[model samples]
Target chain A: MKFSDFFRKKSSGDVAKDRLKMVLVADRSACSPEIMERIKNDIIDVLSKYVEIDREGLDIKITQMDGEGEGSDGRTVPALYANIPIRNILERN
Target chain B: MGEVIVITSGKGGVGKTTTTANIGTGLAKLGKKVVLVDTDIGLRNLDVVLGLENRIVYNLVDVIEGNCKTKQALIKDKRYDTLYLLPAAQTRDKTSVNPDQMKQLADELREDFDYIIMDCPAGIEQGFKNAIAGADRALVVTTPEVSAVRDADRIIGLLEANEMKDTKLIVNRLRQDMVKRGDMMSAEDVVEILAVGLIGVVPDDENIVVATNNGEPLAGDASLAGQAYMNICRRVCGEDVPFLDLDVKKGFFARLFGK
Candidate 1:
């Protein structure tokens, strides 16, 4: 949204790791970045209808489950786990 | 038993065959008996890359189907006595040889060779399964590109799932000038994204094209890419070889100023 965000000098090191992790998580769950963003916006819209919430503080991420193990079929089944955090919910007057 | 290492890249044109050929030759040059196996089956290229295509009397399917002995099917390399190749069958598809047969073949070869390097076909299909089935370790080759890195990540997951824990990363076709200009991903960036141990980083060298066209892998050549492959061989041999400094501009100013 900000011009600084557009011109931000991407760190050559960590940027790659972050992108890789994000892509890997999205790939395993069969979700794309655009889909994930849309889902986040939809969730926020639905939540705002029921209760007041801090949209800026909200977070959503897809991650791989801990522990390396294969499925019963002996195929490595990467567990796609999602986490959503809402800072606070306000009561409707 | 010799180590069976599969050179794989989930995406095509990522230099799996080139890496296999060079590493296989590099190991043999180090006095280890190494056999390069072309497991692509229908679309084979290891023989051509190693310049042993014309010498192929029998293919891998011939040896697996008991039509001929494995040794009888292996084509000896003219450059090294310890180096050999088991060319893939061009007529048949990936379904012709299953993972079990591939495992059995690798097991038998383990008794005779110090390193059995399998040149895996691209994609996460039957060909991939067959190649990794017998591998004690995996060396995933990927370029420093978004698509290639993404595929490499998927491959790492698949390898982990298959219980192939000893996987290493080889970032190939890297352009040092691009990395310096922040136009391309660096080797460090790829390794960070893939979350694997770094084996070697091969710079994009024109000599690679020249060598491939000549049906000879630039393993021990004086070229930068060839030196990278040689370093990979050393690492595979359990030697702690330092990574090549691919930064092009680091010494340019000093050279110009004579500092």
Candidate 2:
């Protein structure tokens, strides 16, 4: 059973709306899911440029942005934003 | 003994200096002796904001260096007999002062004034640490924008780490029309994310520009934003004033667009 079904099945539209709000909130603050998508896409693109991409193995995580020493000076994003793992996409000569 | 309060915003240009100057003036106008400190270091401007630049002689650095007495370094505001300013050094960066110096200075300033308002520089760098070093309380200024809100959330976390027991939020530059159209973050939305007590809500007004150019401030009185400031000051003093109108007339498009 999907997680949505655990609490009385939610409509697809409801889930999407919730996702949009969460996404926008995160995006405006520069830590939303869309950002991870962008990074993952870029990484996949670069990897494809070298060898065939491994979509399933491509691990991407979303986290909050950290403003450690910056203080609150810019857009309202979380401090200590997130930690993302990057891979080497060197085209073997 | 006076309470030391630092008006800070994680983001610059969100009105931390303006809030400090105006709140300092407001408290003074309330018959309380207040002193304003500019902690922006090399980018000093609280003096200019308060129209006390020309009167500065012995600045904060001079006093910190023991070149002059703290009393001598403090500029007496011409507009108010009780108000004063300890202007920051325009030539020096944030490295010139540290937390110890700020705590000692606040301890000294407490002897006479009813309030000491420090205008913090932008960012969570050395300047920020120094500004809040002696603060008994803090007022975080923020615009309704996402960036400012995000910065505020982060600052709140830092303040907690620094052990600042008292914290309040002041949302500046709010446009009620936009909120009416759901195009802007409602004050509720901001408060929801920051999760700090709401102190004041200042409207985006041209009067703020007029006040700045005229060496005046929105005191949360005469003007919409001014009146908001006044309420914040009152709330700081432990008053339970209701929220300001922040009232809006839905634009025609807002009306036509929905309920």
| Model 1 chain A: worst 10 consecutive residues (lDDT sum) | A71-80
True contacts kept of 1: 0.42
lDDT of each: 0.87, 0.80
TM-score of chain A of each: 0.45, 0.35
True contacts kept of each: 0.42, 0.00
**Model 2 C-alpha lDDT per residue in residues B1-259, reported as the tens digit of each score:** 9999998888989988888888887787777899999988899988888887788788888889899989998888867788899999988889999999999999999999889899989999999999999999999999887668767867887899899999999999989877754467778777766768888888898887887887766574577778888877788888899987877566899889956
Identify the leading candidate in terms of lDDT: 1
TM, every model: 0.79, 0.74
Worst 10 residues of 1 chain B by lDDT: B246-255
